[model samples]
Target chain A: MVAIADSVPKPVARFRFILDRRNVLGSIMIAPAILYVLLLVGVPFLMAVYYSLSAYTIYDPSWSFVGLANFEDVVQDPVFQQTLYNTFIFTFGSQMLGLILGKFGALVLLRPFPGRKFVRALVILPWAVPIALATVAWQWMFDSLYSVINWTLIALGVVTRSQAPNWLGTPHLAMLSVIVVNAWRFFPFAIVIFLAGITAVPQDVLDAATVDGAGFWRRNYQIIMPMILPIVAIGLVFGIVFTFTDLSIVFLMTMGGPVGATSVLGFAGFQTGIVSGDVSHGAAISLFMLPVLFIVVVAMLRFIRRREV
Target chain B: MGSGGNKNNRSVTRRSFLKASGAIGGAAGLAPVLSAPFVSRAVADNKSLSIVQWSHFVPAYDTWFDKFAKDWGDKNKIAVTVDHVPVQDVPARAAAEVSAQSGHDLFGFNGSGGAHLYRKFFINLADLVKETEKKFGQVTTIGKQLGYNADDGSWSAFPDFYINFPGMYQKSLWDGIGMKPDTWDNLRIGGAKLKAKGKPVGISLGHSNDPSTTWRGLLWSYGGAIQDAAGKKVVLDSKEAIEAAKFVAALYKEAMTPEVLSWNDSSNNQYLASGVASYIVNPISAYRTIQQSNKKLADDIFVIEPPKGPAKQIMGAASEFYGIWKFAKNKEAALEFLKYYRDHWPEAFKASEGYNNPCFANLVPKPMPILANDPTSTPPTKMAILQDSDKWSAIPGYPGPATPATDEIYYAFILNDMMTKTATGQSSAEDSVKMATQRCEAIFRKWARRT
Candidate 1:
């Protein structure tokens, strides 16, 4: 016969017992992250919405309600409309260029070439570098006076010194230049996504396609691409969100210059709200991005859900 | 046998140790949390002052300023913190501070200061301005226009220094071309000739302070005004403005490269210093920068008054001023520091190498020491032309106080864009004027309602 104390089971500590509940433990683990998002992101987002509907400004920190007046003003302004159009063009143009570059990059990196690891690291440098730092470097490269590209073109005798293009000055070229920098910045991330999606396509499927006499291009286009469509679409969605809301590239490179030719929503919002101290209109300009962003996110997510095999 | 028994009694388990340590840590942390308020209050009341201003365009000025501030703090028995933000980021940083209702005690503004924009957030510096005036004659006209609020008859901020916008020209380049950019017609004709030879005059047309100031000078010299003298009306749609816009367009086509459309405040400096630009309208900082880096290039650079327009020769000046925040913790200390800084204005002027002109009439009296006797300048009298810069200098809301609406228009880059659009062939001069007028009216109406 065992003693009474030895026969009974040991009591767990109260804290441990509480933590043993899955719900309690899960909530405790995620509490900080949830709190951070709520306080930093959610609160500011709600404040922005409130500001959009009010006559708030840095000078006059009042919250007197103004209804849709700010939005109405923004809509009527031709510059805001131009900015909206530019944002779309910048987003889609850069996305297409980035995706194409990324796809080709993935194909090239898929092979087991010598020094593959070094090459891969070099390829990721653009995305790995901070955006502002990279953009500043690009700004110098596209500089009106000191652009290396123009210097090279002139040295090659392809263009005369007088004919060297003002990369950030001409309206069309300014837009193109910003798009190229942004695409270059983004292609590395796109390549990573492409590689992951492409790698996920099994050897079995490729072997089957090969046995069925599918050439390399046919195999990639018909068999593997269909399976990786969901991932690629998801990547494109992220690219859209990022490129659409970007401020650094446009701000540092062109400053929406040559007369608002390259102005995007983000930079415009900054110019109006922060620089000009007109918080209400700035908030309104920023909120204009939400509907489009929401639609793209939701549509892409739905597509991803349906296409996932 | 007795030592082993004692060791066994003294040994502690991990859990028991942790429990004891946790109690000790809790008490240690609780002491600070409990006393933080009282300690902060004590520090705020009499011990610390903070200052935030732009990183000066001239690096040496910032070096001198930081040391001066530190020495002052040491003498005063206060812990002083000075933060230098980039010029472009100043407005946004100030907005953030105002929004949070907390930040540095002394806020410095470059170029017109925008005291009118955030007047409510700043304490009225009338007494301080009056006291300074007693010591050093009356503040200059443009200084009053920049800092004084006519509505309440208060000086919302204290004018510190004014940066005169003179034409910085590559003397060798202009000499080779046999032209002097003393008048608008001469700049156009001579600039066209120079551009044909692959060297162009570079006045910024970008959305930067340089362009903003340059265009206003042009507008004013052409007899155009953004607002009437009373600062109560938008007069940007005048025939003179249309002519000014057209003149810029012709200048862009005939005399300037598209590069001017992309220049920032520093670009013109870089262009002229690189020995490429024939002429640019800017402060003396550009020449000073060359003086530091390349003495030979500095020798070739010369200063002249802004080009003469048909109507007048007025040019816009960049103004620097300081304001004490109403919510500042150590207001008295901040005021004291300003007073100290004010008393030593001549030293500040020397540190800036005469780039900063005193706003007070008598602080650095006639023949202005630095401008009169400069070792670095090519002739050692190259900068003496700036002695009468105040005569040609006009604030942004010219002929009137720079009001909140004018401040808004300035920050929004309305005038800059109007000139840019017309120059770039994006819009007709008339259309650009119309668009700018509409924008100005909208801003004016918004700000007018508050007044």
Candidate 2:
């Protein structure tokens, strides 16, 4: 042991050697990024946790430590429960629909077809549009009186002029509209990811599958799908996270209205924290989703590992 | 070997000391240097004054602000710029600025209760009032009328404009019904007739941000008060309130379309513009929009004082008041700009093009004639609605002081749940009121202590 220690050299000497010119330069190069994350992200995350445990108002200077009172209140609050349920519905509904549409869209575009490139380009239009402008356009399309949809329906004689439906007035319908809008806006991302995944599937595998007498759907399900399952899962996770936290669509479109049918966790956080000036409650509401989010992330990681195995 | 080792040790010590000291210095110096730009920018920009006020107030009062800015710049050697933001963003944006401890010299908000809710961020205009009144005769008259004593001089805001939310209808439609709506009960009958004729009457019954103003207007018209004079209690569950709720529910059942539950600030205007509805309980702003947007309809539209209820005739007052930021670097300039705005009322009124009526009774002897000839103004009848506004206007929190909980209850409970449930027939009017009252009492109790 003494001989090995002597051969290894003194701790100070080892430290000096590790901090030699090359390593020092590398450390210096990465320092800014490290410090940036530490200051901006790490500090704020710590502060958010601290605030979640306290009763703080931006309007008032006095911040009292309320322990788990805010969390308890959030659990008891009916609005919070409704918002949580809406958030889950919005995220899951949009992600599933988006994935299916995106996958199908990518497959359709993959085949040599007329105006394939143009169609692919057009597919991205919804994603390209600004949320505010898109929401406003949707608002016009769904207008109770002058909606294009209503006009079209009336013109087609599918519905009488007097029977024009109020698309955003009904509670269930409003939730459906928001989910549809969210799916429309985010589905292009899924399409792009799935397209990349599909492209990565070796042409040799397809040739082999064809030689094995596998049909198109059979080949897709057996070979292409298993190969890209990880990517699809990744896309699903991202979609769920984005939809769960989104506020602009619901805020600008329905404002969590039509009797709070569209209210989600994100909207509740914004209203409670920013609008009502109850920062603690808002922080608490946001933290309410942390455990669920953690579970999803862990599940996603486990799924990816299983896929690798 | 000894010479080389001593040389290495000297170099290492010097380098280590330099690096440690440099890091310490950098960390220490970072905050001030980074903060300098913000501080210097604010100081350098001190000569300039920025205002976020109602759209009508800025455009209508354009010549006044322009002339005043030029004159004030020449006289006081300070440049001033006025900007207009929509009315809805005024409160939220102002609150954000206050939180950031920056932005805007003068910010205008909707009502007295709103002003009080954000009182912590505002400078007491008492000193400014003395300075202004000494220079100009009176910069604001409504301030005095609203119990803001310019003599004792504890004013925080300068009252700018006033609006009344009463029942407005298409005069042609009402005339077709062969009955004029003179009382509050007349709304139900007229609305039913309109519905029979295939038109739904539009009324806002939602838990929107503006619910307090909209629903409170209906409540007061029915002789319901949120509280008595002291404002220290909640009286929203009173018999009068229940009666008003029942009446509203009946109106919703008979005449109003399902869309009323989804209406927000722009819904009433949209309803009138699209001709989807014939009558609505809304502010003059809606009437002004219709008049400007569609002249043909403007001629047929008539504004009526709120219908007399079983107990009284009441209307909700929608007004904008100006307050200087307490943390403003240029408080004197902000006050001067406000004074200049007030002094040039005639030009301001002209600029508003009859959209905004001055709250100061003296500045506006009567409503500005609707500029029907100018083609930009709403029709003559639309402009005539201002007269009705004067007769029946209740300030928010009227009969009592406005509380945050009062606004919250108005939005969250009464508008969102009770109104929707009542309209949808999910709950009876009494049950809706009962649920709303229970929720309101909880909120009021929580916030009353805070106030």
Best by DockQ: 1
**Which CAPRI quality tier does the interface of model 2 achieve?**
incorrect
Off by over 4 Å in 2: A1-40, B1-46, B54-71, B128-154, B207-212, B360-363, B366-391, B410-413
TM-score of each model, paired residue for residue: 0.93, 0.83
DockQ for model 2 equals: 0.19
Candidate 1 structure quality by residue, lDDT tens digits, B1-451: 2322333565776789999999999999898889997788565546888999999877889999999998999888788889999888988898889988999999998656378778898999999999999999999988898789877889889998888999987788788878899998899999999988877899999878889898999999999999999888999999999999999999989999888888778899999888888888999888888888889988988899999998999899888899899999989999999999999989999899888888888989878887987876779899898888988998888977887678778877889999988887888999999999998998888776555
Report model 1's interface C-alpha RMSD after superposition on the true interface residues. Answer: 6.1
**Number of clashes recorded per candidate:** 0, 4
lDDT per residue for candidate 2 within B1-451, as digits (tens), equals 3323334345556678999999999988897787886788565555877777656533435565566666766576677677767664555676588778988888776644555556567777766555545654454333443325323446657667665566678888888888777775787888888888876788766545445565676687667776665666767677777777777778888887776766666777788877767887776566667766787886677777677777667666567778888888778888887776677766665666654566554555454544223354444344465554555666655666544555454435344566677768777877777767766665565454445
lDDT, candidate 2, A1-309, per-residue tens: 534554554676777877787978799889999999999979977777877787566545346787997788678666668888889888888888888888898898789989989999999999999998999898777766567988999999999876877777788878888888888888899899889999999999999999989999998899999999998888888888778878888778777777678888887787666655566777888877778888997899799889989
